[model samples]
Target: MASKESVCDSYLSLKPEKATIIEIIRSLFSSDLENERFIESSEEGKLERKWIILVSVIVQWVFLYIRVPLAKIGDVLQKWLNLISINGGLLMLFLNWLRGKVVEPDSLSSRSVLGNLDTRIELDKSIKPENTRYKAVLSIMAAKLSYENKDLVQSVVNHHWKMKFIGFYNFWNGYQGRDSTQAFLFKDTQSDPNLIVVAFRGTAPFNADAWRIDFDISWCQFNKVGKTHGGFMKALGMQPENRWPLELENDDQHSQFAYYTIRKMLKDLLQEDENAKFILTGHSLGGALAVLFAGVLAMHDCEYAWLLERLEGVYTFGQPRVGDEKFGEFMKEKFRNHDVRYMRYVYNNDLVPRVPFDDKALLFEHFGPTLYYNSCYGGKVLKEEPNKNYFSLRWFIPNRLNAVWELIRSFILPLVKGSEYREGWFMRLWRVAGLVFPGIPDHIPQDYVNLTRLGTLLLPKETPKVQHSE
Candidate 1:
């Protein structure tokens, strides 16, 4: 059995349920965090750090109360959306309902709420295999599809993308003590030796577990690699025994760890076809996992250097900061040494990319230039996206005005780009939400899909001029 308590030496773990009202308020001024049963830390926490912990616990407490109802609402909404699709349209749905001939949606064939919001299952036709943007386009598509069901994934991969569906998995999280992480693998035949793409699923809209993980400020330190998000590491399937062992013996009976299992699969496949390369990608939380996956491979470089050599790239969209400054330096060195391409994409005002608070209080930071696209689909390579920390009084009206432009762009894009760029009714509603919360709607895969197809800037070639790298 994996013992969660014994996982890391220097760490802070939050248990909101174990806290009291007095303790929660007192934590802000308290230095001895280890003294509190609700807070677990290797050493005394700074007053500023405890403030973050207080916010985290409070948010988690609220989530615990709303998790079930939120999930129910999402379930009902997804089913309703699937009904509209299954019946062929909203009008058709109504007409069929009057005649008592409405079609029921099959759960296996239906899309998740994230999928229903965008509803584009096909890859961009204009982006060819020869195009430099092809992998990034394919990556965003895979990241979008990752939100859908397994059958939907197979259908899209086989019928539309003309790819082989490897498998869909629900991997185990040791800390969560159950299967909490999800990812899927497929092989793209468009390339000569066939490229295998492993896309980790991003945070689901209704999943409280994922939301809690995202908000958790807990961290664990590695010898020379620096500290990383404890929630993300756990979600990536870190085991309690020695954290990350190169190989595990007689592990057949135990639940599969995402890192080890995916690593083994890629190793075997690469060995079978020597010329094949692979890419890791995801959107939002998935994006964090994708980059960290690459980071971990680099960490075990001596034993698994072959995987790094065969890795084509890592592309992430609306991805949050994963680790500290030192960790960022470590990964940058690894990428530079391995000649691996790491493209972190941020569509205008996407809040997810700017999180886990990169400040003096929190150690999380995003490394490398961001391939940022504004609402007009204008692209730039920047060291950091504007409004690096999202909550800003300075950007308040400007952000909402930008949101208004996005809403207008939703109407104009179809005329300028094509019918393919037209926003769906549900997607437009999400854009409305942007008026209130500027970046939340922008975090959706819809804008990401549009930007990849319409954005002008080609990466790497356009990146090195130091366009916005202040």
Candidate 2:
């Protein structure tokens, strides 16, 4: 019999890395002239006889202890056991055959060459910036309170695009403050009045800058409350813990707030001396708000239509399902001037993407192409173990068990429940286990990969040169 090391050596000599999987299998099964004579001469036949005797004795003892009296029952049990043993032995033989065939001699060389070539090309491209007609600016808007603190506001806006992070408080203060708020404050002061990008951040303590983006735009909160109104803070949902509002604020309040702010910005932009286009983008809660505001703009007719006609586009990231199906369809149709592209990024089997909304009345009827990446796969391991085999029985058995368990929970459990299984105690446990297990790969969101690809493609093309005048 050939030693394990000798078998491995022989397999590696075949240059499995350069060959296809089928070719590798063929090579392993092909008769080798040198090894044939040794196998024929070996006393492995005697060893096989001894193993069969041992198995027979064990089977006889098991049958005696079980107290099965009939000779026919004993004979049937023996036949079943023999069949199981034969199949198990065949499985092991096949696995060993694969192991010998699948060794890749030049894997390291191939991987290294590819890595080096990619790195060199990327390095060369990063050094140079391209000049393009359109400048891409990422505006992160803040919620109400951030606008009040001038220092915080200044810090956020000081960087690129003079981005301002506004919150509900800022909106309230801006509109209802001691002095009447100017409707289109930022729009009045932009350098290139032709192109504008407006993005909103959702909820309180808004900090859009927390997420990395290229540009920043000054944001002003549009207070969405009127008299017979609770205090400004209460309407904005900033009341102290003890004073939480008992009733949910109407969608109209939120819609009006977003509409007023957007209208003011548009009026100021159109009123400016130069002609420019505008684009709107937001994520999550902000995305819902952006859609609402866009719908309102469409409703106001030509004053807004003429302005939006010059609009470039709208991109909402991870936006919840919002508006009735008909309203959603109406909004998309009415906004003919701009293309409303909604991008939802889900992470690791997250349930947030399935927000409650009428499917038949979905505003954005079309779902864009989905791009997948393996970032979350193989779990985010900092280091790989040395001398670890990618395919091993030890690794496969547990993985197979895990796969079976997941299929039962994800597929079977739902059938029993008569509905889709929500992530509850049992689901959470499995997710936690998946995180720990190396065999089970993690799931990554398609949007995250798409964004990265977009960044790579665009980043090399241009670098925004920030200009400052003291």
Candidate 3:
């Protein structure tokens, strides 16, 4: 109890319960509709209403001793109905979220919308920065959809697409050659096999667990790193009694799952020629994995070392913060003089970049400067200011909603797809729910593709020069 009190002393003088209550009043009146889209506004409203009821009754009892709306207890009953309606709506939304909807593969999926870029760009030539980033977005989208109907994937171009498919993987529990991380190399059909896209896939539409795993905040030490690597002063920012947000445990980065998937790729892909060039790219979860893979490969010896040496650049869309400052600083420093360009592309109101950060601890910082795709000012990809992460009462709610959503998505998938497909229904609920609980809509691969297309057109015409140390 003494220890608890001691720890409590360091917190901002505001009472914790008072803080939540303040949130209630603020939320009840808030008109921020954009934020309302990703959160369960109905649930928050109920908290506000409950507090209002408690306060009103207390005032009545103190002033009159007994106020009789007792005869019109119907009003009290009506409030219950409102509660049911709000909760029921959330429940339905939750159910729809759970009933895991499978993404039907599109050959013409947004990635191929790169128009003639894929068929045109060659290995001998330097790729314009925008086209390189576009390919990264394409890689991530493809990684996520790799498990879609083979016909659907091959359906994009020809019967021969997957036949020439190189290094596509199927890794998961009981994966019958179809599961998450359905990543594949684009070399076989590319302008140059030597210049390949190591597209790690993003979260799949069918697997709630994939997104859940990606979003999980439990940080473990990165790969083989031993100790958390920040100075005492960084920790000094928090009151000593304040238990550091576990997410801020400096050495512990988001590992395990992404590393597991990436480890599967290291051995096979190492067989490429010495001069082979790999452009690493992906969206969302795939983006995080690309960094992990690239970082770990950079630390390797002999054969695998070339993976980093020949790495052309990394382009990711809406990726979350993956590592503590050490990992960020390590990658930042390691790539500082190297040939690789690690860049994260973000657009609109992407929330992923702000997350995995608990209480704004300086634990996780980004690698390179963000290549912000600004559509508001003009459609262009430009370097933005240094990033600072925050913790919001608003952001916390969606993660919980997503967890419940994942549970629903995993077990209730049967409801999503019967012999008569429910694509129409699934889309309707997803669209409606997105309006109510707006979580990461911009994180979607298509949005990334569309936003990137606009930004790419704005990229400077001059090709970025490469410095080859070899």
What TM-score would candidate 3 get against the native? 0.51
Which residue pairs overlap in candidate 3's backbone? 37-437, 37-438, 38-437, 38-438, 98-408, 98-409, 107-156, 143-201, 144-201, 228-251
lDDT by residue (167-274, candidate 2, tens digit) is 222343211221111111222123355445565543211121211010101111111210011112122222222122222256444323434545555666556734
What's the lDDT for residue 369 in model 3?
61
Winning model by TM-score = 1
TM-scores of the candidates in the order shown: 0.93, 0.37, 0.51
lDDT of 3 by residue, 388-466 (tens): 3424466556544553443344234336433221222323344345444444444454345444433443433222322
After superposition, which runs of candidate 3 have C-alpha atoms over 4 Å from their true positions? Answer: 1-144, 154-163, 172-181, 222-272, 301-303, 358-362, 374-434, 456-470
- Give RMSD to native, each candidate: 3.2, 31.3, 17.4
Q: List pairs with backbone clashes in candidate 1.
A: none
Model 2 residue runs over 4 Å out of place are 1-150, 160-194, 204-256, 337-350, 357-470
Residue-by-residue lDDT tens digits, candidate 1, 1-470: 11212235567777776776777778767666667788777757443556677789888766766777987898899899999988999999999999999999885568899988887888877778777888889999999998888888998999999989998888776434343578899999987779999999898998777787788777887767778888898788766632765566667723487887888789888999999999999999999999999978877887777789999889999999999998899888888777788889999889988898889868889988888888888898888998998899999999999999999988998898788888788889988998999889999998898788888787653223347753
| Clash count in backbone of candidate 1 | 0
**Clash totals in order:** 0, 22, 10
Which of 1 and 3 is ahead in TM-score?
1
Whole-structure CA lDDT of model 2: 0.32
Model 1: residues with Cα > 4 Å off, grouped in runs: 1-9, 20-32, 45-47, 174-179, 253-255, 461-465
